[model samples]
Target: MNQTIQRRLYKLYSSSSRSSFGLRNRISSLGWIVVCGLPLCAFMASMYPRDTFFQLLGVVSAVCIAAFVSVLLRKAQLKVRRLLPRHASVGRPLEYTVEYTNLAKRGLNNFYMLDLAPDPTPSMDVFLHATEPGEEKRNAFDRFFLAYRWNWLKSRFLLMKSKLFLANSVGGEKCGKVRVELLPLRRGVIHLQNMRVVLPDALGLFQRVKRVDQEEDILIVLPKRYRMDSFDFAGQARSQVGGDSSTSTQGQSGEFVSLREYRPGDPPKHIHWPSWGRTGKPILKEYEEMFFPRYGLVLDTAVRAEQEEVFEELVSVAATLTSEMDTDQSLIDVMFIQQGAKVQTVGKNVERVEAMLELLASVEIDPVADWAALKNAVLKHADDLTTCFLVFGDWDDERENFLQSLSSFGISLVVLVVQDEENPVKLNSDYTEITLLNVGEIEQGLASIHL
Candidate 1:
């Protein structure tokens, strides 16, 4: 397709999608009556058997035309406020309440409210470049024109289900509450900005839609998580500096050894009030060296386009470990590479595990694996790590080299390779620490691990 023509077609396709959704949602039961009568009206009018047939068609057409005009005659103003939850997970129903206040003098009646999320429209460049999986298998016309590409992008956004809630009435200068439930199709932030309120006329043929500008708020949708049992990993805990105190932001802390005069830079928490009161001077508590174990959770972001599902399964696998692990015993570092290697820690005194879940929720696949950078990121903290759990979409040379590199530092390694049934992974016979998990068989594969 020509670039200029595709750009024009993109605009047409986008407008058509929005118009289709609007027309379908704004029509009432009586509206369908007019639609069903159209064919009959055409057939009867064409028969020419009698003048009465033409007269009947004219009468029906006038009524439908009058209803359309009547539906457009009404006016309304409303203030909408939507209450959203702090977080929602994919495949879960996010139920919230919407409060509508009548801002106009007249009472609002026989209306419904339709909650909306931002449309996930694909850019022209993406539409042109990205192909739906198996797109080449389609017919020549479809493959040439990219017909399914439009449907794929539309379907991706439309996967979220939000229903219209009916309301009998809301009196003038009054508020009404309607519960709205939305099933999120994907994980990430759901931005709520505008809502649609439909007011149907007495005939119920059509409705007047009023757009309400809502105060934009976001709801974080966490990635799907699987139920996991306690499991042991080949990774071991390494002795950490300041022991458990390493988990806290304070410089260094351990068991009480003695009391010392307060230094200018001593943390507030380390101040000994009793000793200070006894000596009539500021004093600080000193402690001995400590030992705390930490673990590393490495996720391979190097994914090919065909292995998108494998990547999702890998994330769920990582999420399962992140949420199910006993963080109290140690700190966990979730590491992945996007443009560069990044690591975030979760455990006692650090960010909660939910924080890591949020990261996984938004993590995208790196275009290419900078294995050197990722290894360096892990190696920087290798001394504090007891063991490392690695998740990969493929067991290739890059991954095998990565494993060997980390193992060289004496870090116990457990590698999980998500397999695609169409292209089964070849297990390296020498590596016994590898776990093979099929794409759709994740639950059963992980079921074998228990403490």
Candidate 2:
């Protein structure tokens, strides 16, 4: 997230490109057409001094100046309030309503509202490490200058069509609602900084933007979920010892089911004294096994810079699996490594599936991450997990050994290696429950997979 050479280049390109687009949007379609030809007219007039191009250029420039001035003088007093949803998804278009209360004495016309947000530029670390798809095949200048990479990373944060039409007219001291749609380019939270009310001139040559309000709002953009109609966790209860006991009201007494005639060697604590008193013979309280089947969703983070796309695909797959799992029937422990080992559980007695997805949305790739971190995390709860799904960025000896060790722990293994079609990854050995999912064809592979 620092300002490295790569990050600087990215920031430079992002700023220039956004500025160009903002200027283009500020100018109306007619104004842009004239402006585009104005430079050509100037060039022609320079080449042929007595040409009519000079007069045309002068007239267009004068009109643009007057229009710009007209917009600058006209001001709109408006307060903006936004109604945003709690969450959004990457690549999905989401709509929200914005209320504009006009504070001016007269009605305003031909204006729109634009949401302001912090620059969605990638951090220095991200800019330097993550390679844009087909980046190597680009021209020498583009590859060296990182123009392709810059735009690709920046696009991840941009809210498409941030500009929304307010209304043709809004009366003084009145409120108007405008439905605005924005496409999220990336997962994680988008920090909306402020709102702007754009006032255009009669000719619509330029726009005067007024800062209506400064309010920080956030939209949690969930990861892209590759819908899987069927995915089997292949989970089995690890232990029947405490099945539903922990969730019961009288947890210390286990999950009570019924009472039976007391048998030899029955614990006195299990004896139903009231029933015993009524029947003259002792009775014991019976309890059902309480443990829910728990499975591990392991997300491997040891990814290289060139495999950023693979990491993203991996996260999306993990997120999709999390969404598809029936948490009510089983427990899922999402395991990954950050600075250290981390694990989050979601199920009947744990957090919700949404919480797990939200956590996955924030997962980032660590090129130097140690496999031991994930192994340690998984082993910590291995005794309770029935099966483990290892979503790996790449397949190597380390990951293979990790699986073998899990086998020693008697955990069923399902290895899913996420890679690009251009550069496919191979499993080190012939193993059961291993699925190779290409970047673009993950869903097909998922569907065809039996377990």
Rate residue 12 of model 2 by lDDT. 80
Q: What lDDT is obtained when candidate 2 is compared to the true structure?
A: 0.78
Clashing residue pairs, backbone N/CA/C < 3 A, model 1: 235-387, 236-386, 236-387, 237-386, 238-386, 243-290, 243-291
Per-model root-mean-square deviation over C-alphas: 4.4, 5.5
Q: Residue 338 error for model 1, in Å?
A: 1.0
lDDT of 1 at 361: 86
lDDT minimum window of 10 residues, candidate 2: 245-254
TM-score of each: 0.85, 0.81
The Cα local distance difference test for each model comes to: 0.79, 0.78
How good is model 2 by TM-score?
0.81
Runs in model 2 deviating more than 4 A are: 1-15, 39-62, 121-140, 143-146, 156-161, 235-291
